[model samples]
Target: MNNNFKMIAKTLFGFEEILAKELRNLGASNVVEGVRNVSFDGDTGFMYKANLCLRTAIKILKPIHSFYVRDEKDLYRKIYDMDWSAYLTADTTFAIDTTVNSENFTHSLYVSQKSKDAIVDKFRDTVGRRPDVDIKFPDVRLNIHIQKNQCNVALDTSGRSLHHRGYRTATNIAPINEVLAAGLLLLSGWDGQCDFLDPMCGSGTFLTEAAMIACKIPANINRKEFAFEKWDDFDEDLFDKIVESSLNKTREFRYKIGGYDKAPSAVRKAQDNISNANLSEYITVERENFFETEKYTEGQLHMVFNPPYGERLNIEMETFYSNIGDTLKQKYPGTDAWLITSNLEALKFVGLRPSRKIKVFNSHLESRLVKYVMYAGSKKAKYNKTIKE
Candidate 1:
């Protein structure tokens, strides 16, 4: 049996702690969290599981080598001296992505260039040929990190971001990232225990991700490929076994997962995406305006979504947010609602106090994931009273 080794899972800012928790729950050893990243110990099969199951992770990397370097010459020498044959061959295509935080190497592009040169040159010197570079779809994707005089090289196991999930073929203007959607759901302590809803369900990303989580479905079950499949030692049988094993672990989900959007077009797109994800049997999308709708499920419901944060402070933003609060308080009793937005002022208009406020990012915008709980048999959501026109 293979002994345990360390691997790093990179995530969005503010998700490291939750991702670390996920790793711990997945049976990772020596789990540690860092800024936008988490480090943990697992064997080869566990590495496969982490790649296939971790939703918050953008990429999973296995460190190949690390050492100190003074300049580009030293970088090339050390990299060229390593046994590249163990990972790649002259016939294979590869890509190098470099990140540098040192004054000595300000340009990451040059670092990638130099590192690629060393690898290719080493292959030519040793095997009388060179490997080809394939940036679009590489056989092996390598990562180079240089911080001052220290350097670390890692293999990218998940070629594309794990957020791809290979399910979302339809998208609207502001479709949320799958990883962010899943992370926010996990942050809300959502399990399969309760019903769920995404009121402003543009493209139905939140609903789909929530259903997948609730059912314990493998996060990447729909993903087309993983970088490990392209490696020299790619284990097809082992991967098939892992996939089967993971699929067998899926739990039954009895509760409903629902979504709504006022725009018929948005509802149509959400329905299409949900069908593409093959979750139509489990998720239902409709065209009802959230303000006019009430809780459909009789038991406790979990709500999470992204509402429009008016960029220009339009009156509709205020009305929309306020309507969100009013709907929750007036109609949806025994529910916990969580929404993320960058518009702090607009969020204030909602009026209901958020039980939790977590800092997160939607792409480049700084945002907060805020939650409001309407206890069972309690009053509906609270919002600021409006004056008549």
Candidate 2:
């Protein structure tokens, strides 16, 4: 039986393409990319696989219905008309998440309230009982997206954001988001071919993500649960089979991946998190200042890290960035170093030219992922002309 249905995977800015490619590679049919999201067709088993394997997705939503809403009353009526019993029971707790971008619906809170009312009233009128709203940990979560007059009602299949990959209980002051870390690694063309390094590794997010990517491990192999597990029609045996199949596809990684942090606390935290992820055999973490240390590998090295962006960390941006450039140029040869920072003004102080600069957002702050290529031997001396953005 063909039980395929359309699903949407939400992602951060500049990751739509990578998410789309991930969807296609995961056997999604008719994959389509939208702004900050990707739509694809898959079955229930495929959905489980996607939530487990996709590294760049924030959430996977299975849209159940779509309609045009004239007003709040119309929206309520449409929502009330849905067969809520198919998804929720009187004993189940539910939550409604709303995103609005329409002239008619200016406030998402109001939309959520109206949708909740509709669902509650429907249950009350028919079954004489309704589910309670539990925002923190709901048995079922629904998403209502309003774009102009069109409304998309979806079930949140992967709850609590897919970035919570059941690892990293500890974090630094300004830890990078796991989804963003994975996406940045993918954008940098990291395929685990060469030795990998995260110089300013904080809580080892990049290191964990890099190891997973290198070994072809499912992104959420350690995740405890998915929202679909709470669904009425969730098939436990099928999900278990999917998990085993995904694990069977994992490949062995031959290259070494490690991290270095100047701060002893950060190094300890990184080690703890890496150990929690069970990637100790594939990654090494040490307390060492990145600026003072040179490349350890004789072959080409791929470095990715999120240094202190100067917002939460106290440091002179210009001097820090200048030292970064000097160390890369003087010591780290035959390496491709990629870093993301919100301080654009300080990026100019790096002195070396960036081969590529991509616009990305770290939470609310706008940032750039810049790549610098350090050549080997005398060829490094030839990189005199600095390319300006």
Candidate 3:
């Protein structure tokens, strides 16, 4: 029997297309991109694989039901009417996560409370007992999304956001999110084809994600657990087979991935996080000021990094950005350098026309991921020629 079902992979703001492509490449059917999300058809095994492999996905939600409600009373009535025993037992613990976009349901916390009461009341009436709510670490996590008058109820297959890849225990003051790092690398078109570098490599998130992508390794391979594992029907044998198969698909990467940070403490933390991901064999971290260093690798170089955005650090913004342009233009050649920063005004000091600029967000801060292409020889002539063309 075909066990195909719809699943939604939640992602960051600008990663809908990337997530859709990833889903298609992973053999998903009917892949469709939505705003900050991608929906596809997959089975149980595919669900496990998506959680394990999708780098751009924040959470994989299996939508169970959707309905239209007039108000909180209707919402509670509909929720209470559903057969909760199918997903929860009297002894199981569950949590409801609500996202509200409807005028009727103004407060998400209040909606969650109403839904939780419905489910709890249903269980108590039918099974003589009700499952307790565990907010932090629930066995089965449920998603409630209200858009206008419609409500979508989905089971959260991957808990706590897939960005919690379980390998980044040590981080600097403002470390990039793993999903954002991976999405930026994808957007920059870094396909593990050549040498890679993260010059500002704070905590080495980009380095680890780059190495994993190069080697075709699963994104959440190091994660301790997924929310689906706590489900009552979770098949250990099936999950084990999926894990082994995913591991078997990992290929050997011959290219070098390197990271550099000026601070010794940042270097140590990056190294430690890289080691935690068991990627020391493919990545190296060193302490070096990025502006003073020249390109050490030959041929095409792919660079992606997140520099300080002046939010948490006290630095001269204009000079720092100007130095970035100077270093890339004078020292690095035949390199495609990409950086994401929220400092738009500081970017003007760089003085290089970007080949591409994509709007993205670094957490709540609106940011831009800009790319600069440095020609191998006669930088001035090449840039002028391109501009003239």
Best by lDDT: 3
Residue pairs clashing, model 3: none
| Global fold similarity of model 2 (TM-score) | 0.96
- Collision pairs in model 2: none
Residues 265-291 of candidate 3 have per-residue lDDT tens digits of 999999889999999999999999999
Cα deviation of 317, candidate 3, in Å: 0.7
- For each candidate, give its TM-score against the true structure: 0.93, 0.96, 0.97
lDDT of candidate 2? Answer: 0.94
lDDT of 1 by residue, 1-389 (tens): 65899899999999999899889989999999988899999988888899999989999999999999999899989998989998999899999988899978899999999999999999999999999999989999999989899999999999988999998888887889999999999998998788999999999989989999999998888999999888877778888898999999998899899999988998999998888878899999989889899999788899998998775334488788888889998899889999999998888889898999999999999999999988766332233222322
The TM-score measured for candidate 3 stands at 0.97
Off by over 4 Å in 3: 379-389
- Candidate 2 RMSD to the real structure: 3.2
* lDDT-better candidate, 1 vs 2: 2
Worst 10 residues of 2 by lDDT: 380-389
